[model samples]
Target chain A: MGFEMFAVFPGCTLEKYSSELKEPLIKILKYLGIEWIDLGGRCCGMPLLLSGDSESFREVIRSNTDYLRNVVVITSCAGCFRVFREYYSGFMVKHLSQFILDLGFSSFPHKVDLRAVYHDPCELIRCRVAEEPRELLRRIPGLSLSEFKLNRESSTCCGGGGLVKAIFPSLAVEVAYEKILRELPQDVDAIVSSCPFCYLNFKDAASIYSLNIKVYDIIHILGMALGVL
Target chain B: MFDNVFQTYKLRLYEAMDNSFIRAALRRAVDSFRINRDKALKRYSDVEDKRLRLIEVKKHVLSNLESYVKQTMESIESNNSYAYYAKSINDALKIIDEVIGSGKMIVKSKSITSEELNLNYNLKLKGNIVYETDLGELIIQLLDSKPMHILSPAIHVPKEKVAELFSKISGENLPPDIPKLTMFARSFLRDKFFKADIGISGANAIVANTGSIVLIENEGNARYVSNTPPKYVVIAGLEKILPTLIDATILVEVVSRYASYYMPSFVSIISGPSKTGDIEKTQVLGVHGPREVHIILLDNGRSEVARDPLFSQALYCIRCGACLYECPIYQLVAGNFGYTYFGGVGAIWTAFIDRELHYASLIAFTCTLCGRCKVKCPMNIDTPEMILKLRESIHSIKLIPEPIRQIIENVKKYGSPYGLTNRFL
Candidate 1:
């Protein structure tokens, strides 16, 4: 297989809220010997599209298209991945989980013992990337992944999408809290997902509700397994 | 204007959230719905195929809705039933008023269309006594509250609250036991069913070919409501029209399965008034059941929605309400997220049927635009897509909430919704 350079699009949520996931994301890419270029900090027009400001959405799309027109775009943000995959036609886009799975997980040299459950973000589920993240998690040494009763296509939202957090903050947090209470396995040490919004929402929900579980971006766990975190 | 809408919605949402009973009840109901729907759907391997076929049939019927309406009326008339097309809520109310007259007793099954028409209020104003037959609906009727869920209207009300309400109605101390409460309601409503001068119901599907009104229900109240009275009326949306009885059956099955039932206890198919030839081999009406059957197919902006290229797909909804349980926002706030209708699909229905885009504007924004509703819908209505289209229309009219408008501005100007000047490199 030939190593190809891809452009990394760190969507606004990742930059603002879950910036810690960025370092491990870069570390995993480096360990995999993949060359990448940062597309710089930018919005993926998701907010505009969600807000029904299609005119501004188109404008943002045009601006981003100029920079990303010729590259295979990779992003850890599920919202960005969904926007590019569904809306943009001229370029190819892959969620970081899909990108990593396609690159293959050949060897696992380090062990981080933990029992975790994988949350399927609404965007990744819409994009049909449910299995790739789970497959990646299974490859890590000493990490066990369990399934939510409602997983994949049936997975519920993390209550962080469609600007809900910005407008109805309490409702968003309540949704996340209900999901944790109802869906999270009692024995799991952590909940993992690739989407930055899910990461931020779950993190906030767990802390606010005094839930003792840890929340992690899949990259963080993967980086741990590969000795890159 | 935007501020008022948002504030009103926020207030209602917070009120619903503060009610811990409603929160707990909603959680239990949502969990059960999920489990039951998954189990019910798993029994049939061809669920997807059936759903697709129903979608095709719905699309075909909606495409030629005017023709189907004509055909349905003709077929219904031929079956010795009166058929009327109501282009608006006022027209439907007028027709209903004329049929039942004043000082009449009426028993009604769960009809969201009637809710749309505010049928009970209008009929009561005309001096008619109206009773809701479905237990949940009866609960709502007593509470003077709107439905909390499309299928389970009073799901937000806990058993203790129901016992209290029923206790007052029964003039006795009714226990909080489910069976006792149910029996009390049954005995209480049973007399109304017999004494009622008219029965009204909403059809799950109306077969154009056979002129049959198909209704699926678990409580058996609809059977009494449609049969016991001397006159019966069905007020249903024109979108319920199906080309044939077979298509209607398939649709009913899909509706039941997605509504968390393998099959409802009663699947009533009524074509026309009850008649018999037992006397002298000559067919005579008014035998055992209602002698007069009136079918009113309501348009009320359904035709306009059907003509819209972007939103026409919304008419494909079977009203299974699988989406409401699946909706993250609806799970938290229940029916506060909508106006007349509730949940993501309700936003579209509110905008069109209720013709209140101002209210629908806030409801549309309440949705997370997560595709859970679409994935769960047997009709695959794409409520999120419809909501986006509705939002666009609302935005053009400058009905967007201030927070959303600011976010959009920030995304356009600062390249981030947060409007941060510093970039993470």
Candidate 2:
């Protein structure tokens, strides 16, 4: 695959609850003149791993790898990026943030004049791709980024990983509440994260706590800054 | 099926969340531990290499647990100390009863193994007055509260609460001053140590080569308990064995680094019954420490855990409590997150030892499967992986929460986690 050719793995949340993340993401990629195929929605086998169905997880990875063969795969979800890069080796799977960084965007069509704090997804941090998301955020003109005291490798979990939201919502909410209380600056308007699961969780938690904060996937914010969405 | 357990767990969680004091206390404790852990690790320039070496040592020991146990038992016999294998908690208690015969007073240092066996309650029922010598354990023993943290048993209790609990025992109004509280506990426990007929302590690492036990602690009480009593009983898990004293020494470094981030105030290495040949060139037991040192190696499903390929790493835990301070769920619920032990590692151990499927299911599912515990663990025990394996077993039984089941089914059917492939509102 050439630099312009790519296949997109939007992941489960991106296909459904976070479809809004897709349009901005696609627009930004199109703006960069990168021709990409929409591989549509697919399970990244994380839920399978979480549920202790490694057999099914392996089977899923095998088939996903077959579909993603001979293509540069761009993943919107940090969870998907992790499973693809770690578990599947056939395709060159890169996080959308890392892909954008590689594209080397020198200027944006529009500046996103908003103060945002970058929340590192646990999957990305654990995989050592934390810098990619931060670099993506930094490229946005007129956007000021405030970091949590605990960021990168030591960054707190967004309380959304490991399918906790489905089974242990209360515990997940408490975790999110604690992370926000401890890490988030009170002045930030938005909590920008690289994972859809994290985005959904922070958004839910913001409402639960009645905090006037908007949560966005990095693609959404970056796309907004580029006047793509 | 586990509705009541989940209810109780949620109640405790909500109560913990509501209690500002407990949350703040946990945060402060974790911050200090993390800082200290970093400080302690900074002392060793090759800290990561040391951790990897410790991991290898534990892995090798766990894989050949039976051989190590045999070696440890033989070494203990050679040292003239009695070693017995207890198949169960009841068997261990029975052995203790037989050993004691007529002895009553007991002073015990901090031992999660003893907690696992509920030794204090059983000893008390047998009419043996048992005193917990560790300050945290003593505080919880007085308050009749379960241990919230592994290393710091009474971490959930604030200083003012400790002051309150101590004041009641002292029969005087005590200020919330920490030093005053420490003095009260010290004065209260000093007599018990001298009066106790037997001392019971847990082994951090049981050296198979020398048949010795290494105990790391900050308080002088463990030494007092082990040294002052005429008879000493060590109740340890069979999984505590190390191949040699050299390995055990390394473990002491690992445990202390992970536990308190400092080489503890004392690291007690007890080989056998204390012997002295001072008056004559003839050795005699009961010279300074205990006359008879009886070691009861408790199995209590450790063999079953060892047999399990997925969860065998659970045995690698040195009980440093590093995972607890690093666990997100534990930071919120404290000890209430688990039954006997605390955090993700505790959940795995409880699942194996408790033998109740419903109980284990509830505890196992509560873990978020975050890998922070894995990163922070000295042994790199993949507790989240173990929990997931437990969850998989639970999933087979269809005991998973309804909401979770729905999501799983949704993902299976609709190719989306939420089960909606259609347009969103």
Candidate 3:
């Protein structure tokens, strides 16, 4: 398969707390014979758009689209995938899950026995980029997936959207906590989601609520299974 | 605009979130509505097709709004009913005052259009004895609370609260039995229905071609309000017009499916007045219902909304609370999210009507832009899109909050909202 080409957009979260998600991502891509280029430090302009700064949002969108106009840009963040696909139409954008699902990994470096419920990020669901993450999660051996009663398009928010975390952090956390109490599977070992924002919110809930469940980005779980984390 | 309202919004949001009774009621109501809506839609082979047809009809009428308004007025006049156009809230109230003309006993059915004008408050301030007839609306009126939902105005109130409220009103310590409480309200309102000189109602759809107004409800109070009084008045937004009775019927079906997931128990189609041709084939206006019918078409910034290409889709809303059932934020906040109208649709509508953008901003900002409202809407009104547009418009006027401005600054300076320097090499 001639899958040796794509520009990778590792969004801001991957540069910070989710940096661990990258090494395994790279290893898995390499194992699948995919060649990727780092698109460098740039915001996808979602925060600006959500926060009522249209001029800067425009500038960011213009610059990002101008840079990636010719190449297929693969994003590790679901928000980046949404902004690029929906707003900046100059380039073809894909979530790394979609790219990986297309490339097809032969084996995970190690098997992980994980019983997880997938938390669909609003951006992923709205952009219809939801199933790729679930399919990728299913690729892991000995991992069983259960669903929240409200899943896919109707999934409860992680309370990170529309800059709520920046504006009303407590309210955001409260919403996240409620989602956990109401929707989360009682017997699940972990909650896995694809969006970094959702991952952060869920992580906050897990800590503040002192729940004994691990919250992982699908990439983090894949990284553990690939023995690269 | 954004800052002043944010504090109150936070407090109200906290209160709403803390109230377990309201939360449980909202949860159950939304779930039941969703399930009922789904099951109801299963009867049709193509709900989307019907929805698209309705959207087309609405768009056509909105595009030709001026001519349609004129036509509707002419039809009402020819049918021996009076029609007047009110350009603003004060203008609508003035028309209502003129029509009622010092009438003391007044009864009103559930009308969100009336709520937008604050008609009841204005009338009460003017010393008219006005009673709300619809059960949910009457409950909210008794509690002196704003409506919490479009269809179910008192959805946030628990049975115990209603029982206590009724006990105080009727001087009887009523149990929380729903039927008994309903019986109390029915008897309480029955006298007002007959004793009133004027009945006020809202039109769901004004059929321009036939000069008929359609009112759909489950409570049957609209029928009493429109029929029992000597004088009847309909206060409706100008956008509530359809080309013909057939279109109105289609709208009734669409609204029923979306509002509560079943056909409403009552539909009142009043053409002009209570007319009788039974005597000698010579028509007389008053027989059983109101002798004089007056329909007031209130503009209230609808012309501007119609002129807007992006936002005019908002007027296509049939007041079906389907989006409310689908909305996560509205599920939490109930009607506290808006000033008059609630949820995303209310935010856009209030932005157009309310000058204070403070209340509008607070209402609009809480939306997460999840696009679920659009998915749930039969007309597919892009509520989240309209809200973001409202934000952008208010931003252009420099009304954005300080925190949001700082967040934008942080994103600009540090490529992330967290304001951290790049840690990845």
Candidate 4:
């Protein structure tokens, strides 16, 4: 792969809630021979936007825009990716799936036999990043990808967007449960997501509701496939 | 104050969640609507083009709202029909009261505009009997419950509940079977249609050039509601006006397709009261349909919404209710997520039309801002964008929920919503 420098924006949820994802993400990038820098941890202002505090959101935007002006930023967090794409300008923003797809890897280092359904995060799907994540999952030789009944633009939310989990926690879990029951086939080995919020919500809901299904972030699956775990 | 509102709203949402009947009904309805809408849109390849064109048509009408309102009124007058402009909900109620006196029997098709006016309650207070002719609407009326969905008003009620409700009403044990329940409602409401002194219906689109009120429905109820009575009245928002009949036709098509109907069974274009020149070239009115036709063009905050750049797109909605089916929050809480309207688009409508900014304050936060509603809307109204904007207004008033306010404060203090530094670093 050609040398390209990228900044990895580990948004708040990934930094605080699902830090397990960070190592695998960095290892995958390193194994792909890409030069990357960590942008450190910061709030993406999505919570502020959700709370209707545009003034604070603008302040955060001003500081972050100035800081990330010079680099091609990549993030695994859907909410941060959305805030960057919609609220910020003059900087290139790419979801990690899009970034990985752009790098054009030919094959996975190892074949891992597993069947999983891909959950499209609302923000990334709306940003038209639906196909890229699926494309990345497809590249793994032995991993079988099943689709949610409502995928792509019509994908159902996992009930974690717009600060729902923070404010209306039970309602969010119920919505996540509905998505699982209605959209997911029972036969899949696991459910995978590209967004940290989605990953956390699905994991929490599965455990709380005592659902037998396992949940994994797409990076973790990729890490396993690439022998980087 | 914010806490009280948030608590009350949360209580309602929790209640909705606990109702397994609503959950089951919503899940089934949402699934059916998606499948039916997809199938309906697939039959017409030009649906997208028509939607884009309808957006332009709505934009044009909204820009020249006063002109269209004027032209439509004039055309209706020339067609021997009465036209009344109501600047507010009270004005609309007063007009209806004057036209429909005490002790009159009124049959109505489903009209969300009337819901905005609280028309049925006010009409009943004046010693008038009002009947909702649409089956779902009748079910809601009997239960004295607010509509849960725009098109499917009683969508939250399962068939078994309907059987129980109908069985009580009929003094006979009715089966949970759909056809039996529908037949019971039909036989019960059939009398009102024949004996009604007045018929009231809502317009899907009002034509400015032709002075026509276009009604789209699957149940034959609206046809009877408008034609069976001696007096007919149309209660519609001023935003429903289109420049021409052709524009209205396109809107009707778009609404039906997105409303999950291949084609609505009945499309009524009422130009005026029933008239005929069959008697030796002399024009005479009231042949078969209603003799007196009244068009109540309701402003009711729509003009204000149209004037505001950010909220003007909300008026482009045709009330197809596709967004409600697609909304995750709505799928869970149903109509509890909104004030009067329901779902994301309903939040915008509630804020502006209902003029209850405080209620909107509570309703706005329930949305996940998923943008699925916009994707499903035929008008492509960016509801999520409007929601954030509504939230900004709500935030200024300090009505944002405490937890959300905490998230904002935490972001400011800790550079993270969780109020913690990067432990991973």
Candidate 5:
């Protein structure tokens, strides 16, 4: 993928988090022998669209859709999945984990028996992308997963999104605290997440707040199984 | 405050607050708010529409607040109620202090504005007997804690812990039952309401046409707080003002149904102090609903908000707090969403209004940059854009952790932050 991958950012991945997962993501894809063409998309426009700026949102999406043809769009953010699956229905969308499992499961030459719980992103479940990640995770041998009590239809939001973090930090933290308090297992060694957004946000939650909890990206874990290191 | 703001960000706040006693107190208080709010929302079918209409009304009100507040103040005076328009939090706080002498008993109902000013602690510091009458607020008060949720102040507290708090605070053997907890708070607050000299509340909507301050709540306390006291004061955010009574009426329909509530048991519309055209058309203001009503119209940076183009758009928020429940990061870490403000949008506002207030640059950085917060926001505040601006500001200052900084620098040089080479595996 070229710089066009930057468009998924709207403005975020562009400026603040531009470097996140770039190397790990690129290395994994290359190891999996997957070809990811940029297709020259604009900013995912999720941010602009979410703000009720439909005009800017439409303009950005129109530009993105124009460049795509018969290629599966892979991204690690559940937010991007929501926009691609529903907003731009023309392109096939999958979180990077699913793409890796589909194209590179047999390419794996190592084994991983890591036990962890998966933190579900609200969008993946709320917007109905729930089962795909689990199906993909199952394809990897010796991957033990735990279930959240409030999973799928009953899943609660992570509270990291919206302007809550910006506008009302106290209330937003309260919500995140609730989810982690309820969903995270008491004895789990690590938490795995498919969405990069959820992955990083939860890392902050676990490392800074809980301190004892551990977290990892699904792609990062899968890289071990594929002997891509 | 600036010296210590970043300290809170770097250290784990929740673990610090996670003493066994404090944890128990939070668990007890949060459960009842959830149950009551759930029951309220269950009674309504068109909650989504009501939420949308409410969002639209808030946007319109903020857009036209200058004219609406003038009209509202005129109507309030025409009806014998007084409005003290103040341009800042201090201005409003001073107006309240000047009117209500210190050390008097003050009864407060549910209002996020009260929390925003840290009003209870401020009042208590001045030797006033302050009683928070709202059930959730009462529980929090007993614990000497700040509110955890806007609509549900004690949402972080589960029920069993509330029972434990009740057993200790009230000297009663209350079990962990939710109903018992409600009645327990009610039993204690009922006496406070009648004997209290002052009543303080927050308005859901201040109708300019009718000069009415609308109090919508599932509990009956807001009614008693407004109606029973001799002196009633409303400390309302400027965004609460709406154009017409009919517009507000549509909003009452929405607010009652979808405060993430079923239908509020009580929707109090107090146009003015309880007055009567007794004996020959002469008006008398004394009766019920307070002999005197004072509406303190607070700016607290709202006017500056109304003036700006880039950030002013978010001033349209109606404080529904629904967006928190729909968030991803908010769901984790329970109450630690990340300090004074948690979650995505709060971080942006914290950064914009005063970045010093929320030093967690992590709160802004941790957002997966997902637009979900905007979708969940009733006003649809563009959180992603705001977060980008916040992160840009934070990164520019190099407040980023050293490891993350090295990552970004690597990405700058090698086109990948992980410091990986171009070779496959």
Candidate 6:
């Protein structure tokens, strides 16, 4: 397969939601000219792990453990990146955001000229994920970022967790938009997240005509950067 | 009326607080209230088990409320007590009128359903004298105000105002000393037990099999209200029913511990108005309880809630108000943040109970959604998430205002949230 898996999407990424970020992910790969095996990466299955369904999750981990051998797992999601970095053995996982920064593509592909508040999704900051996304975004020329009064571990949930969506969908959107709208500086462009669940939930909430903030995944920002439609 | 409801719940709470009397009165009760809950839960080890059982009981009742209501109505009728299901608030008031007719001095216990139905004002218009026997309720009644918190009705009223109320109600110039004020009210309400013709109370839980209405209160006013009068009316929201007395008893434990009762304070299980059949089991009303016991099972907004998977859990709330006290944001703003409901979870409730509220969206944004309230909530109500869902409904429903809609449109088009000119640009 000779694939250089540079990143991974963590479990519960619900990757089906984003067609916008795929080609750009591939384009950035094409620009860097690295082999990207986008699929067959098993879900980190952390949602089940956190919910106390570790037996099934261990089975998943065992099955996926073989795939990561001798290959780098590249992920646009910080959650996936954190899982591989912290838990999984015999795999290489680098976050797409930091990878772009390392590749100097944060400056090269496109400059998304916006002053926005970057939110650290719960798992991304308090969990094993690195602070590299923040470090990388700050380095990107002309990408102005402001900190929320409360972020990182102190950051709020969008109310879209723990199978809360299937059980309670309205609450997911309600709390997501609430957290998104909180800490508005009276002047800011939008809210951005490293997690796709947060990104998508916040995006749907943003579309609801009550919240005035836009939501974006980091890969989408990179999509804008890499000049892939 | 809907507009005033928003004012009463949102704006007026702050306006009432500005006088400092409300704040002082609230502080007087708040500490004591928090202490009771802390002490009670500490004493009870199996409290969580009880809560879980209660949750299971409530789940069964809510899942099969239609059949349970049918069962409850039949049993009460057999026991010579009457049952009327009011699908709406108006219907409940009308049914209440058939029982009361006119010229009645009512000694009622605490009923949030009655408050929801606005029955006191309706009955008062019909020229009936109504006195609230629940100590907390009495304070709110004397103040001519609404409940600020669920358990403590006059939680917003400070002691100075209570002193003034005691001075006016008792005709004795009393100081704002909390014990003194409480003693005065106790003496005053102890007398209302004997003089009232009709007693109206709310059931904490109702058992379908036995047709028993369970009341859990610390003050025993509910017991007096249900027992002393010739005719007693139970006006409960339809969501209160449980399957059996055993299940209802388990819920009583949860309610007591979570509501901050050290021991099961006073559990009154009234079955069909105290009817006793001696020789032939000829059920007689008004033996140990009220002769004519009428229960108005209200639907008003509960059934609409039942249709939605999201908001239905709000009905599952056992009226514990533990969520309100545990809320960090609620600790700061109290009743002002949300409407009559209060706090982040209350904002979702306000939307469900009444849709026209404007402050709900404004208040919804106040929560950090730290998930602490859900952590403390015994039911695991997931209020933070519920608030978000309500926000979505409010935003996308086309019923929201245009400016808010424009703001949402900006999020989809630009990556920026506020539609601002990018400072980096």
The CAPRI quality class of candidate 4 comes to medium
Candidate 3 local lDDT, residue B7: 77
* Docking quality tier of model 6: incorrect
TM for every model, in the order presented, reads 0.95, 0.93, 0.95, 0.95, 0.69, 0.66
The better-scoring model by TM-score among 1 and 2 is 1
Interface RMSD after interface superposition, each candidate: 2.0, 3.5, 2.5, 2.2, 9.8, 13.5
Q: List, residue by residue over B297-354, the lDDT tens digit for candidate 5.
A: 8777777777766566666666666556555444434345544445566665455443
**Tens-digit lDDT track for model 1 on B261-362?**
988899999999999999789999988899999999999999999988878888898888898888888887788888889888888989988989888888
lDDT measured at residue B141 in model 5 versus the true structure, 0 to 100: 87
**Per-residue alpha-carbon lDDT of candidate 2 for residues A91-124, written as tens digits (9 for 90 to 100):** 7888888888888866666788878999888888
Number of the top candidate by lDDT? 4
lDDT value, residue B115 of candidate 3: 87
| Residue pairs whose backbone atoms clash in candidate 3 | none
Residue B324 error, candidate 4, Å: 1.6
Candidate number achieving the greatest DockQ relative to the actual structure: 4
Chain B TM-score against the true chain B, each candidate: 0.97, 0.95, 0.97, 0.97, 0.85, 0.89
Instruction: Give the per-residue lDDT of model 3 (tens digit) for B1-425.
Output: 45656877778887887789878998889778978888888875466677789999999999999999999999999989999999999899898888886648999999999988888988887778899999999999999999998889999999999999999988989999999999999999999999999999999999999999999988889999999999999999989999999999888888888775568899889988988888799999888889999999999999889989999998999998888877777777788877888887788887896555876776767777777888788898988789888888877777776678786777787776657666223
Rate residue B255 of model 5 by lDDT.
56
lDDT of 1 at B275: 98
Per residue, candidate 4 scores C-alpha lDDT tens digits across B85-135 of: 999998999999899978999999999999999999999999999999999
Candidate 6, which segments miss by more than 4 Å at Cα?
Answer: A1-229, B1-39, B276-284, B338-340, B354-367, B399-406, B423-425
When candidate 4 is compared with the true two-chain complex, its DockQ is 0.67
Docking class of 3: medium
lDDT of 6 by residue, A1-229 (tens): 5745454443334333335444455665676776665552245644333322344446656766766677766777554555567667886666676666666544544677877778777556645344677776665566788878656654556655433343234545655654554445656787878877678778888887466677777766656655554
lDDT of 1 by residue, A19-106 (tens): 4876677777788887778875788889989888889889888888888866889998999999998888787898887887777666
lDDT at residue B41 of model 5 (Cα atoms): 59
